[model samples]
Target chain A: MNIDSIKNGYVIDHITAGQAMNIYHFLNLDAMDCPIAIIKNASSKRMGKKDIIKIDIETDINLDILGFIDKDLTINVIKNGERIKKYNPELPATVKNIIKCKNPRCITSTEQELDHIFKLTDKKNNVYRCLYCEAKAGK
Target chain B: MRHLIDITDLSVEELDELLDLASDIAENPKKYQESCKHKKLASLFFEPSTRTRLSFEAAMFDLGGNVLTVSDANSSSASKGESVADTAKTVSCYADIIAMRHPKEGAPFVASKNASIPVINAGDGGHNHPTQTLTDLLTIKREKGRLDNLTVGFCGDLKFGRTVHSLIDALSRYTNIKFVLISPEELKLPSYVKKDVLAANNLEYVQTADLEEVIPQLDILYMTRVQRERFFNEEDYLRLKDSYILTPEKLKKAKEDLAILHPLPRVNEISVAIDEDPRACYFKQVLNGKFVRMALILTLLKEAGTL
Candidate 1:
């Protein structure tokens, strides 16, 4: 509540509240042992409202998913109270995995333990394509 | 490609390439019979589908490949509460490629995420079937001589028919094609499909429940099984069934150049007497499917540098 800051960690800021949990699962923050603070529906003067996740430990996350799911995620990694590195992943040229294809008939949509792989066909539009059913993806 | 989940994946050019390859395979079956000799095709069918399952197996074997099929989800680890992703991952390790069918919406997409091999969707709930679209494309090419400028009338089960949905999406790409949708009131084409695929493309189409009213207007009559369950009352199905049947009497009204197609294993939706008609090409469509699938395996593998 006091703008609770982490001693040494990263903060994923400026995420939409609606897509916050999706971004959370995309980054797999809960699976990590790091001390984390996830603040959802935080009032923001710039964007009216936003979601933020602060990690209090030095942990590397799979940025591929974060970039695919929510390209707007702004990651500011702080170490010793100084910005060590920041990752604002650009739209990846191709999506390896993330955001499952919505077509149930897509081979990726099957119940078997196969990887749900999709190609990032249209980056600006966030359009993905299932190789099996060939359905356009992303809501 | 990582997944053959829907028709939108392949562009018109790509679809033609696959179809061309299929035609070549069909023309010269012995030349490519052992094409996928050592390759294994794993079929993970969570839902029961005899036609699609057998088609996929037959396609793979026709290419000299073996199959590892799991047709029953109840018998698989899915009954033990395993997710589709986990099952597809483990199956990817054992097979060169996989074909899956599920009862849930978007189930194959979940499986393809964990699978390493090429994932071919045999079918899925009521979503899409790209391969079937490929088969339809091939059939169209063989029968109509071209995909363009043909008037295709889909009669029956457009609301929940995966084939209808996929074929609509695929056909929307060609130039000067017309659609005549003939279905009972309870089973008209979904508005979303009309909005997204038909109207958006500025394609011309008309909707009518009276099959005979417009049977003569069709260049292609694609029939589908109109089940009693699709109706709220058995009486309505009985009333509608005979009206839509592609009997010899109905064929008289159709054009001489018209081709009658049915994605077979059809019930009473099509009369046996019509099979002798030169234009009744449903059986030819089945053979076209096998050829198209063979072409698909060749083209995909060729692109992957595996064939």
Candidate 2:
């Protein structure tokens, strides 16, 4: 487990154990040309066990996807091999084309071209519902 | 300043205000007759709904405003592949307010996003019918003389009936509102509604197939048509269609003051003999629908600073 530290890149840290693969697939990290390493089940003092993704090059990441998948995830910006910034992404007020609304009668289900959008209606309950049919999102 | 996309869009205070305005309009119709004198309403109904469309037109007419209508998609540019946003923008130029019904669940929402004028959703697919919810609230308040502390029995199609869902969501906010959801197993209320609206709010509700068991306990009995269009199989529709018809004998145990309401154009779910019963208030509900629409139109126009 001797993963090299990146000089200038992003380290998506503190992902819930076993969620690294989901985050990887959701962000399409496989298609990137940069070097990436996923360390799963790394021991942590706060989280107990976590997964971390280390990218070798600095690039733009879709924070919305990160927030939607795991709101508690922290992104560590590594510059000159030093952790420059560590911040957790905020849950988006609204997300478009991320998770498909599963309601059969939803317009998005029938209309292929329409964007699948969900709005965060209950922040305290952490509930996101389909904008069209009002069906709770993520089923 | 926003559209009435869902019943939830209006706060409880706003809902109470609308009901108050509706009651005032009901009491003195002549006073609000010229409220929208120089304004106009555009009814762009991409779906065929006689009651909702006509009610909106009647509301605007009673308010001394004119109406511009495109009753169906085939009669408008929509048949030629025009998008809802484009049509809404185009209609905004001709009307001060827009009331639209469409087969797509979010078509009215799209219109509200694009149009400069205020947009009211008449009925959007099986998604929402906010005005019908408003009508139900007005009826309950007018009949029972209060909005809270009532047992409501919602019968027939709870699954596909947008009116039932909307009314339930609206009533869940009031105090001591209990719901008796009566429907066949196949047409039971959706789980999300049961969880998000009822359980989330801690509102007391019970699901039952026996309407008779709950009829006697209800302060308001809201009947909805078990729509054949919602069923995948014609045989299934036929089997469940007559399962909960409100006959006089069934109403024998009902409270004398129970208000029977149906967002009309009802089929066989309600017997015509029940029409003579003093409890049958669906006709009065229809009239209240018009007055509520008038109140809504005035409220939206005033919010937009047009009235």
Candidate 3:
């Protein structure tokens, strides 16, 4: 597999195996008009099996979106044909439209215009509750 | 502008002010008879609520204010598919304040976001009824004479009872307040509430299925009905409906001065025989609801500069 290295882009690595597609869809990678490569079940020393995504364009990505999906994933920033920085995304204080409230009584269910918002109520348990109904976010 | 969407919207100081104002209203009704003269309140109830709707109307009437009511969703512009925001904007034109009740949670919040006037959440599905919490607080303060240093036992449907949740949130702010949550296993209080409100506040709480064992230790017994409307399955509702009946037998072991409170329209969770007991404060709670609501309307209107 001869995947070309990106000149100026992002290389999202260390994704748990079989989660690359979810990140791709959540990040709307397919909608972008740029060269992208998703390597699934890639061999790794630290992680037994990992998924990697390479974006050819230096586009800004929302780390919060990635962090909410899985905080353990590594985010690598590339510039001038070299790796510039690498870090992990922290749990966001709040998320909007990332996950919809499944509670039928929630306002977001009836009012389509309302944003599906969830706030991190429990940091230790990584629990998120709906802003309106306070129902725990579904896993 | 201020709105009463949640009990936590009011600080302990503000809550105390409301409580004090409510006490004053109870003591001297004539003093506040003309406080809201010429001011109008719009009652928009999209669901059937006999107590809350009447309480708001009675509160407005008590203040010598006229009321504009939309008692049913089918009779309102909502049936014509008007959005809550549009309705709120339209109502803001005719009223000094808006008290809205919707079957969907957070409808009043949306109204507050769009309305020019302050919006009070009368009752929103199984979510929040802030005024009810105020009623319960005033009842507790009047009965026990203090909000803190008391063992409060919440009996029956804790899961779907918004009053239970709101009252717990309100009481968690006071010091030395312990909770004895008595409910069936399937209808126990939600863990997020326990974690965020109880445990986070460093409040001691015990969860149990038996209410009788913990009855004697409680200073206040907050009874809640197993609401049929909140249950999707009839079987589940039927199974839990009679989980805890506060009969005369159950009260034998309870404290002599235990304040028994219920947010009413109760469906036999409390026996009618208990109505004659000295400790039964539910009816008094209903009357306190009107006074507290009057205080709330006055406070919001005053803060919004409508007064």
Best by DockQ: 3
Per-residue lDDT, model 2, residue B307, is 75
DockQ (CA atoms), all models: 0.15, 0.53, 0.70
lDDT of 2 by residue, B1-307 (tens): 5688888899999999999999999999999889899899998888898888899999999999999998978989989887787888998888999998988888888789889999999988877889999999999999999999999999998987878888998999999998999998989999978987999999999999999888899999999888778888999888877778999999999999999999988878899999999999999999999999999999999999887
Candidate 2 Cα errors over 4 Å, as ranges: A1-3, A13-34, A37-52, A58-64, A71-74, A84-90, A99-116, A122-127, B228-241
In order, what lDDT does every prediction score?
0.79, 0.89, 0.91
* Candidate 1 accuracy as TM-score: 0.71
User: Which residue runs of candidate 3 sit more than 4 Å off their true CA positions?
Assistant: B226-243
**What digit string (tens of lDDT, one per residue) describes model 1 on residues B1-307?**
4467667878889887787788788788999889999988888898898877888889889999988989898899989988877888899789888888887756676676678777776776666677778888888888887999889999998898878888988899999989999998889999978987999899999999988889888888888888788788888888888777778887778899888888877888888898888998888888888788777766666665666
- lDDT agreement of model 1 with the native: 0.79
Minimal lDDT window, size 10, model 2 chain B: B1-10
Expressed as tens digits, the lDDT of each residue in A55-125 for candidate 2 is: 88876666566877888999988888999999998888988887898877676765576788899988777
- DockQ of predicted candidate 3: 0.70
lDDT (Cα, 0-100) at A56 in candidate 3: 87
- The better candidate by TM-score, 1 or 3, is 3
Interface RMSD for each of the candidates: 5.3, 1.8, 1.0
When only the first chain is scored, the TM-scores of the models are 0.84, 0.91, 0.92
- Shift of residue B68 alpha carbon in model 3, Å: 0.8
